[model samples]
Target: MEKLINEIDSIVMETQQITKQFQKGDEVEVTSHKLGFVGSYYEATIVSIEDANHYRVKYKTLLTDDQSAPLEELVPIGHVRPVSSHQLGTTSENRFRQYDKVDVFSSDGWWFGFISGIIEENYYVHFPTTGQEVAYPSHALRFHQEWSNDDWEA
Candidate 1:
């Protein structure tokens, strides 16, 4: 029994020391679970490696604080692969026009905004929360529904 316990402890320590798929500085996206349904995904940084498959993640773009998740829930971004062709979901041309509400992926993470104009394949977006505008590729954006904010109307 003593030998068996010692071997188990050694295995645990060895597994903990193994480098995780994502490092402390790696950028990743964590899926949000609401009512047991998969919901919106938020961008985050891997703050620390809790174990072989778990990570301490920080979602600075979100209004909330940091959270932790498993490796299966993270999609690596930034210096690694950034955005892949599959993730962009641009198998073919997607139609998007001006004044359409959309969610765009920026360095600051995914944000809900309106398309102010289009310049070729890129769309100029205006975020109401920050009143900032930027041009984003169509592949990095998706349609979003409007919010009921009558008080913000002019």
Candidate 2:
């Protein structure tokens, strides 16, 4: 819905603030109780920042220890908050950033997609879950403080 996208846009703006409070390689812990399905707890590395509202969080599955099995999480700036100031014996200053790739899902909560490219006013996505190439007009997608990064691998 248009309203949803607008709301998400507003929240995404905070990524800049969160980034300013943190930085790459900073050990971070995320509380998941209030978010999407992955919402329970998340511990990851601030691998990269794409912008002020998005982040490339590199972390492993909590239940798995396979180093090769790594997931780069795209968390909104507003969704990630400081739970611990000290991560791995260091303090982090939010850097307000994002990643080129962000996980996206459909409005029905039944789709998972990855942003493959970013343009001036839109992005192209290859949704593995549905095997569909979808284009988003930036204004069509909605984001919540809690977001779902699940999609079928296309």
Candidate 3:
């Protein structure tokens, strides 16, 4: 029927628009109604786009090593605006400070680093091992103690 055709077209168009808003390698928050994720947001990597609306996402917090989910349940993190520090009834002093040692997660695994700077709620971490810089959300980082070059571990 013409109505069915129109609905399908609408779905396809909407999917395309949503897909355009995200890209491979972007971090996203995935929430699933099934099991433990019922009320939590999990950090994930947008591995690839399987179709207009589905994305292959690898969960950063998988209990086992390297588990990936099919495109059906992933949502881009950037789609949601982060709450400002003031909104949490906190101030800049209560947040992570510059040069603070922190552990950041990456595709390889969790890496140790220091907070170089902050852009909004995201922290720029400098990894001493490879001299690489990466940006991670606050949830993806943890407070850490300073480490020497010889004591570093990935």
Candidate 4:
């Protein structure tokens, strides 16, 4: 059992490292740093690559002040991640493991983070935007996914 778990972990790590660079028209999720939206990732399409470390994305949900068009902005590449292929499901504490990307319910919205450690019935999640580690009960955590092509894939 232990060996099998190790093998699975290896596969997961390799898959994560295999993510390639983003290109135009690629659907993705971008972390928002705006007030009241920090730590939240929003659906977006890569409209253009500004450079090696920046992308001009048009948000699917966010809109302009006049609400006439979708909001577009330049986002740092590090703040973007490929849309997750896992869907949110019933909370199962045992299903979580170290290094797994997850979202935690907080401040009225789901905040993107990763499982840094597990302690008994609690998970220590690290939020990259805040550089903070927080403990959350399993019930408040879920696998991160993005809504794409009229369905949830991550």
Best candidate per TM-score, number? 4
Q: How far out, in Å, is residue 11 in model 2?
A: 16
Q: In terms of lDDT, which candidate is stronger, 1 or 3?
A: 1
Q: Which lDDT tens digits does candidate 1 get at residues 31-84? A: 433332122345667777665445667665654333253333232222111111
TM per candidate:
0.39, 0.35, 0.35, 0.52
- Please estimate how well model 2 matches the true structure, expressed as its whole-model Cα lDDT: 0.45
lDDT of each: 0.51, 0.45, 0.49, 0.70
lDDT of 1: 0.51
What TM-score does model 2 achieve against the real structure? 0.35
In model 1, state the lDDT of residue 68: 52
Superposed on all Cα atoms, the candidates' RMSDs to the truth, in angstroms, are 18.8, 16.5, 18.3, 8.3
* Ranked candidates (lDDT, high to low): 4, 1, 3, 2
Q: How close to the true structure is residue 118 of candidate 2, measured as C-alpha lDDT?
A: 62
What residue pairs are clashing in model 4?
84-154, 85-153, 85-154, 86-154, 145-154
Across 24-99, the per-residue lDDT of candidate 3 in tens digits comes to: 7877554343442222234567777666646667665664433453323444332211111111212456567677
How many Å off is the CA of 86 in candidate 3?
23
